[model samples]
Target: MRSWCVLVPTAEGELVRRFLRDRGLLQKHLAIQREADRLVIPTVSRVEIGLPAEEREFDEAFAPIRSYRDVIRIPDRVRPLLPTSFDVIGDIAVLKIPDELAEWRDEIGRAILAWNTKLRVVAQDHGVAGEHRIRRIEVIAGEDRTTTVHVEFGLRYQVDVARAYFSPRLGTERMRVAERVRPGETVADPFAGVGPYAILIGRRRRPRRVIASDANPVAVEFLRANVAANRADLVDPREGDAREVLGEIRPVDRVILDLPHSAMDFLPEAVAALAPEGFVHVYGILEAADRTATTVEIQRIVEGEGRRLRHLLVRNVRSYSPTQHHVAFDLRVGRA
Candidate 1:
């Protein structure tokens, strides 16, 4: 059957195979195919393997049964609750375990580490909390550390998941915003977390300057280090509440409001910091049933701020929960 495969030169096939296996990315059920000078190896996921490999799909035969669940040794009744997927951030695997499976968390973590050889830590995530929006993660297996270097689009970010909020799932959304940034434009990220959006924009776009601020001091520390590592010299990292920090900065051509929980609360501050005819990318969690109502509410807020809503584009980024969605509102505003 056809499946996702990585094509690599015959000389580097063994090395790449080891790398993939170590990362728990190699599909154990499929057989690797040799094609003259190149070898086709199947993978469990489609991602950059940091090797000279080309992603392709081809017909391949299945091997013997080898799944993480097969060795889990759990009761048949609770087997269905076994997580099939988790978030992989660099060398760490984060799992959101159900409350019922708390007793088997250590075994689950071990199974995950066995399934993926490259992971050094396995953490059970209890979601974000507190004023800093930090994740409540506990080490269930392997090393006990929340710090790791995550690579996205060739940029390295030293992230501490326990101290700050960083979502690997937002890679596409960050790129979308970065690509829209025009040259010579000044950008501002009020809730910049580890400089994901800011560094990407600074390196990819020829913006005049990017002022990235966050209320969390640890996030700012990592953001500054990431800016230097990524050579995004144009990004100015600031540590303070965004409402106060934005007031100190000059008017920006684009403002990014990433605090989804209460981004709308700061729409007035965002509008105030924006230059005339500027853009604002605001993210929020809204009920999926009534998207139109959210748009109307945004229109009401923008007009109330004495600004003309020249343009507004609403995009559903992803499903935040069963009933709510993570939404992005792209707005272009000017003096009324």
Candidate 2:
């Protein structure tokens, strides 16, 4: 018996996996990082079967992307803006763009449509980039070099991801943190990016109030637009970190701490602002080998605060690096 692993970049893998269907080539390996330009695999098969000669028949037959060239790199941001920088995290092609651009937004978008053939525009940054803010353009081009636009792409977001862009990955760890809200409960999202969670929750759950914010002005503008677009029930959109404006809002039944790098440092302030028995969802990515230790660290933080941290459950969300894991531990904080 012989066995091996072959890692192919997302675009290439996506191109070939269709052929290997039911052959048992794809394994459930942890897709560590998102923006992978190529795929590294473990496989005993070494023969490269090139694509058919009909690739030129379609508008977008090859991969679609542009080089950010490290002028700036979005850190810890898995689902980023498109056609700028990209990496392959498992079978997905993660794309991201810069924070600000003058006139090239449309140009950048056209580049994506030109590169990734019949690609599905899964997400977008809002109409700040005009009609093509961040949408999943459904263009299909494959082996036969056939291109078809089946669906005129609509917003992937059931709720506009404008004013609050909660990282979609966070849902892996904190499943529907906002979706569980009851009517008349106050909620706040301090680090809303384009309102990933806020809009969905506000529109669906009927929360009494939801205050969302981001330090980035562009993010705030998008958040507001998303709130309006989705018809968010009761939300107050702000443009700064939640901690700074926490004093101005009603006491919240739940608080989402999504600040990058040091959300743990915000624990003290978060505890102070939360209502009695309020729930908090925290995000942290640690090494795979450290899963046990990482869970322990989260428990110790809330325990050290002398509060009773209940529901101490840990979720291995996604893969960041080779041996590193993106983990989220959720707990309910109350008086000790």
Candidate 3:
């Protein structure tokens, strides 16, 4: 069937498209078609009579609806509150819906399914809670299972989101740390969860040995499974407190502490476990304004252990919240 659309010169297509999209006038399900020197974009409303010169009314004939916005059927008043994106792990879709849109969770899940037929589950995130830092998720659609194997950088990780802590967002950060690892050097990930960091380092850098430890037994189980799945033989999966684990495997060439909220509490153990001239990759959550103070504090911690910081590099891994960031400090320490 034919429908009303906005026609614009090909040169001004993107501008007009953006204008329509910003105003929620663009019909996402219909594919943009081109004829002669003009582009035809379908719209839900035919109220473009007073629009700018680039956009003019036209009849769009026989264009199939390939994709549509998730909130197409939702009331205009509530559409703006919907989240535009979500995280996907394996066949599961994890969404962080706002409280205002809580009632439409099922509709949102169905919309996600419409966007990707491969996704088998849609789970709502209630944030990470408790000492394990496990995500509290409520399955709103599809399968009820929470366990899945996520593949990143050609490595596979088996994680149960409800039982273990894992973030697909950290894939690049994991690779960055792995790239810094040198072959023939032993590495330790004291707070390793599901072996994402340790397995990646072992598989990519081929380190001499990687000791991966996690206090959460469920995480340790998945870590061991991931090691076997990825055939990361160099990683030794251990289940225990990071401080105790590091104390047992002391003097490693590199140590990775990824517990952002409380990684500093284990700094003493990290310093004690570092071999001479070894590096420690410490992850923390800090405000942008407090970066300098945090760096100084870390330096003081190292110095308190009678060790000198030979070289230190800090980077903003990601934003933890509007006011805070997930930061990493790569420090090369040695005897004072």
Identify the candidate with maximal lDDT.
1
Order of the predicted models by TM-score, top scorer first: 3, 1, 2
**Tens-digit lDDT track for model 2 on 1-336?**
222334456777665554443465433232322235754333224434442211111121232234432222333343254343443211122344455542344444444444554443322333233322333322121222211111101222322233222334454333356556777878778777666667666766778878887777766776687677667757788887556876666467877776534566666556667786877767665766766775676667767766677777677666655777666666677877
RMSD of 2: 14.9
Q: Which stretches of candidate 3 lie over 4 Å from their true place?
A: 2-72
**Better model by lDDT, 1 or 3?**
1
Q: Local distance difference test, per candidate? A: 0.88, 0.53, 0.85
- Candidate number that wins on TM-score, 2 or 3: 3
Ranking by lDDT: 1, 3, 2
Report the C-alpha displacement of residue 208, candidate 1, in angstroms.
0.4
lDDT of 3 at 80: 81
Residue 216, model 1: lDDT of: 91
Per-candidate count of clashing residue pairs (backbone under 3 Å): 1, 42, 2
For 1-336, candidate 1 gives per-residue lDDT tens digits of 555678888999999989889989888767798889988898886757654455555555644336667667677888899887777888998879998888888889888788778899999999889988889989899998999999999999999888888999899999999999999999999899999999999998899999999999999999999999999999999999989987888588999999999998888888888887899999899897667887887789888878899999999998887889899999999999
How close is every model to the real structure, measured as TM-score?
0.80, 0.53, 0.84
Model 3 over residues 119-221: C-alpha lDDT tens digits?
8888999998998888999999888899887889888787787888888888899989999999898999988999989998988886999999999999999
**Candidate 1 residue pairs in clash (backbone atoms < 3 Å):** 22-118
Candidate 1 structure, TM-score to reference: 0.80
Which segments of candidate 1 are over 4 A away from where they belong?
1-67
